[model samples]
Target: MEMKIGSKSNKIKYYFLVPALTVLIFMTIVPLIFSLGVSFTNYSPTRIGSWSFIGFENFIRTFTDSEIGTSFINNVIFVVVSVTIEFVLGMVIALLLNRKIRGISFIRTMFLLPMMVTPVAVGLMWRWLLNTDYGLLNYFIEQVFGITSINWLGSYSLAMPSIILVDIWKWTPFMILSLLAGLQSLSQEPIEAARIDGASNWQIFRYVTLPRLKNIIFVILLIRTIDCLTRSFDVVWTLTNGGPGLSTELLSLRIYRLAFKFWETGYASAVSWLYLLLVIFITTRFISYLYKQEF
Candidate 1:
């Protein structure tokens, strides 16, 4: 009777888990398999019913294609520059807010408002603000510095910087929130010990606080890098549509154009797979760092 009851309980538990497992497999695994299969084929809208297995040709083209290469370079720059700025700015803001001050709660809430705004909305808002003719930004610049209107999104030299600036504005709050949480949760004992040892404020931060927060910092970096690399589409699409002659064409945007605009489905899938591999490689490195820090 005891053995029978244990078997019954195990069966009941498996029944409860089956639906969720099935859903995961259907939703994620199936699509991934389908896309992987498509990546090797010569699939496109133009080839309506006729398609053939091209097997690595698309993959080869992805690496050799100059446009894709440029876009990948742009993506690297975007990840490094934007993440660095956000981390620094967010860290400083987090440090400042960690202090006891009047209206601290209100200020912290206000700082998060930008992140709360939808990416598309943020892009549109910045678009109007940065417009050349009657934009508020150019208007202020002219009033303050006697400079003429600047073409922010139209100029090749300025367009990428403009996109980076907008990204920094929208995402810095996320870094602040993550780092602030890490800062608050840190044990005060180490900090106190450092202070007791005649360590200056900078010395305490460099030696004690930073080391303690390393794991949290790595986690934040991993999350932000993945998010920024994968989901940079919406805002950038809204702002420039990879615009002004592909000046700001990120890898994600480039994929969008290949898949949707050019209708090069198979090639796009190949490029996407390569891009996915790149992200997985970088994320794996960060996870290794995290594990090292843990041990």
Candidate 2:
């Protein structure tokens, strides 16, 4: 009787799991497979009712297209520069806050306010603040340094840097939060021992704290890389719309313009798949390192 009851309970568990698994497959796997199929074809949405399989053509164009090449380079530069600055700034802030200072809670809360705002809202707010004629930033510069108003988003040279600045402002808090949590959760024994052995602050940090925090740092880097590479659409879209001659066009924004604006569905799909593969490659490498550290 007990065996029979156990079997029934197991069957009930499978029954509950099936629907969720089915939904997951439909939502993620189905679209992925469909899009992969579309990437190999000449399937422009503008020309309805007729499409043919043109295998590898779109993929070839993705490599040859100058605009796409420029966008890809811009994305690489954005991810590298922005993520590096955020990590450094975040580490400094996290270390400062890790100290037992008064009102640290309030300071941390204030630091996180930028991250809490929606990306589009942040983009809009910065857009206004950086406006050439009426922007507070330009106005302050004019008043303090006696310089004329400088166009931020409108200028080709400054457009990409401005976008990177906005990204750094909004996302650095996330790095602070992650690194702070890692710092707080660290076991104090090694640090205490190092201190008792007459180790200097810099020495302790370099030899003791950093080695211990490697896993957390790697995880933070992985997460930030994936997010910045794939989902940096809203801010770029709102701020410049890839203006100033595609100076700030990220891969995601480029993909959006191709699909929606130009209706090149097949080419967009191919580019997106290539982008996905790049992300997967980088993430997989990070995961491998993480696993090595784990074991």
What TM-score does candidate 2 get on C-alpha atoms? 0.94
lDDT of 1 by residue, 215-260 (tens): 8888888888998898898888889888798788999999988999
Give the RMSD in angstroms, all C-alphas superposed, for model 2. Answer: 2.0
- What's each prediction's TM-score? 0.95, 0.94
C-alpha RMSD for every candidate: 1.7, 2.0
lDDT of 2 by residue, 127-219 (tens): 999999899999999999999979899998999999999999999999999999999999999999999999999999889998889888998
Q: Which stretches of candidate 1 lie above 4 Å from their native place?
A: 290-295
Which residue pairs clash within candidate 2?
Answer: none
Number of clashing residue pairs, candidate 1: 0
Cα miss at 65, model 2 (Å)?
Answer: 1.0
lDDT of each: 0.90, 0.92
* lDDT score, candidate 1: 0.90
